[model samples]
Target: MEPESGVNGTAIAEFILLGLVESPGLQPVVFVVFFVAYLVTVGGNLSILAAILVEPKLHTPMYFFLGNLSVLDVGCISVTIPSMLGRLVSHKRTVPYGACLTQLFFFHQLAGVDCFLLTAMAYDRFLAICRPLTYSACMNHTVQRMLVAVSWVCAFTNALTHTVAISTLNFCGPNVINHFYCDLPQLFQLSCSNIQLNELLLFGLGVLMAGAPVILIVTSYTHVAIAVLRIRSAEGRKKAFSTCGSHLTVVGIFYGTDVFSYMRLGSVEASDKDKGIGILNTVISPMLNPLIYSLRNPDVQCALRRVLTRKQAMV
Candidate 1:
């Protein structure tokens, strides 16, 4: 279908997102399940955020980073899931051009933030484990605040470039995005206007945003693991390993899936398998961070137990 002309003569005022799956038979079922997941995702992250804020014991730099990560997770998931829930439950999956732009802006912003925050967390762990003597001096309150501020700024700047680049493209034909959301590559493919610039920008930013920090994380943890090995006592080794293991797990899963999905440079046909894995990084992975980081850490478990016990007593 040809798009009607808009006020400024842009051909696309709205777009039809083909979404994850088109089976009308499955939409309602998908809706029920994903809506529940969305609720749990939001509620669980919020509880973690609240506990971190209220608990004086968790007022350290690690939980501070975790709290920032929880906020990022909530924002990132919210960008896609609410609309996903709506599309799954409703008869229509139409997304207006403005709304798609909004989604693109936020989806990238929050995701970029998550990537950077994870790196920050790795650095925090490195300081704590590898340089315990100077950990306090290195990761003090001023430094922690600086790291978080830099992460947000970098994320916003990265996302804004893509959003503005996307806005400049002319979507003159085939106004249907064949994905659940407004993705950069898919949208670029559908544009009738010259997208060489957008493609270049996407390629450049994709590498810079996802690649650099992954290298940092790998380096940080390589040293951390080596440091863990140097501990003379088995008990000391166990303690260090426990502290770094959960974070390393989350970072590996999140970055591994992300780099696999987005690091492509050409006109690659991203399969359903690709999209599925991307969804894992965006949706499933963020949900797992809080669980994996907190559940596996004895400190966090103790804090949660105390918080819960106090609540139960009050009740």
Candidate 2:
């Protein structure tokens, strides 16, 4: 295929994704592993989403956010895994420039949405534990829906801005992306033009989209922790911690990996170790979210059991 020229007359057609492993013998194993992870991620999140939707008892603010989160997990994993699996199986690791940008767009969009959704979930927990009397009034159905909508809008806008900026860059040669997927920083490294503006925007938007939500989550949890500590009854403290424990765990895993990946933007180049970390945030985290909630949150477990029992009875 003839390489397509961008507006800058740069003859760039596609990018070669040097996938997770270069060994031909390990391709099947890697494909199987990631494919299984993808399946588990989809199945786990779908079950959570189903349990929440079917169980009327779970139709509260917390589960509402959980449903949104499950959806995001499914999306976030789906955005990258299928293409990755295809590359692994076919050994055709080349992705068209347009398709690469599309992946970048959806990946960032869903990831950003996850960050905000987790923050919203934290706020819901804060209200429930720290201000129980006002929790219902504060996090009504309308308010919950509005919070989710705002998250999507903010995430989409951020993703769109980066995609537009990335599209404008000129790629003269060496269209190989080192990571398993097409990421913004990796793309920045490949761009032949000045990337100071892109870097500034990335840092600025990173703070707004990622850092802000992380701060809010931390603040919410701090308040929750203080409130739990002040409770006179041990059972009350336990219950309060249980309420937010899953969210905190998830936040730690996600933010820990993501901050490591993005925060050191100017210091070093993208390494294979960075790709491994990326896999944690992109693949492993989504698979773990449902497991953490289902195992830690009694409500989700009971709801899932109810869903399964009903299915068996119907059968």
Candidate 3:
């Protein structure tokens, strides 16, 4: 294909995704692993949903935000995995141009919102633990709703900027993407048109969306840790530390992978090891999040028990 001007161009309608590697021997193993992860991810998030909905005590702002987070995580994982599974089985990793763009749009939208939501949750934890005197007043229902709305809006706006920027570029030849899923950087590499603006915009938005939230989360946790330290009783300090520990671990892992993924903008070399790490961030992190939060949280555990017992009695 050759590059042409405006409208009809030399660009191909479909993109060949060179997923993971070209090893036929590894396809089945990879397929099984991802398929199981997808099932567990969906089931775990749904369990969180069921627990939250069935237990009255879990209806607070924190649980409400958590339920939202689970739902988003499910979506984030779903967009990438099913297509990957299909490709694995069929030995065809080709994605249509339109589908690639759609994947990019939704993937980033959900992922970006997840970033903001985690920050909001960190702040929620801060209000609940650090400033318990006015937790209700500070994190009221109205505020919670507003926070969720803003999360979605910010994510959509962030994704739209990148999608629009990415879509404007022309891709004339070598329409093969080097990653399993459609990442903006990899996709941009395939573009025949200049991607300097797209690259800059991507870096700017990455900082604004992901980097900014990391900063906010870090700041919130600093306050939370200080509050934990100020508790007079050793037991109280231990309990406070335990309560926020899960969130802090998640934040560290998420931001650590994310920063490593995007911090260095220019001339990124995607070695086999680098791609494996990227997959962990993109695929495994979403699965691990609900597990980490729900399992570690005593409230969620009790709420889940209540939900199960209630269901059992009904049965």
The predictions' CA RMSDs to the true structure, in order, are 2.8, 1.9, 2.6
- Residue 21, candidate 3: Cα error in Å is 3.4
Best by TM-score: 2
- What would the per-residue lDDT of candidate 3 be over residues 1-315, giving only the tens digit for each residue? 223455544367788988876889988888888899999888888888988898787898878888998899789888888998999988888887778888999988998888898899999999998889999999999999999999999999999888777777887768877778887767766777777888788888888998788888889989998988888999888877776787777777777877766655564444555477667776788788777878767778887788778879999
TM-score of each: 0.92, 0.95, 0.92
Assess candidate 1 and give its lDDT.
Answer: 0.81
Instruction: Give the best candidate by lDDT.
Output: 2
The Cα error of candidate 2 at residue 269, in Å, is 3.7
Which runs of model 2 end up more than 4 angstroms from their true locations? Answer: 1-9
User: Candidate 1 at 142: error in angstroms?
Assistant: 0.8
Taking all chains together, the TM-score of candidate 1 against the true structure is 0.92
lDDT of 2 at 145: 89
Ranking, TM-score, top scorer first: 2, 3, 1
Q: Tell me the tens digit of each residue's lDDT in model 1 across 38-119.
A: 7877877877887787778889998999998889888888888888778766768798888888898998888888888889
**Clash pairs (backbone) in predicted model 2:** none
lDDT of 2 by residue, 103-216 (tens): 999999998988898999999998988889998899998999899999889999999999988888888967888889998888888888788899899999999988889889
lDDT (Cα) of model 3: 0.82
User: How many pairs of residues in model 2 come into backbone collision?
Assistant: 0
Q: What's the distance in Å from true for residue 297, model 3? A: 2.4
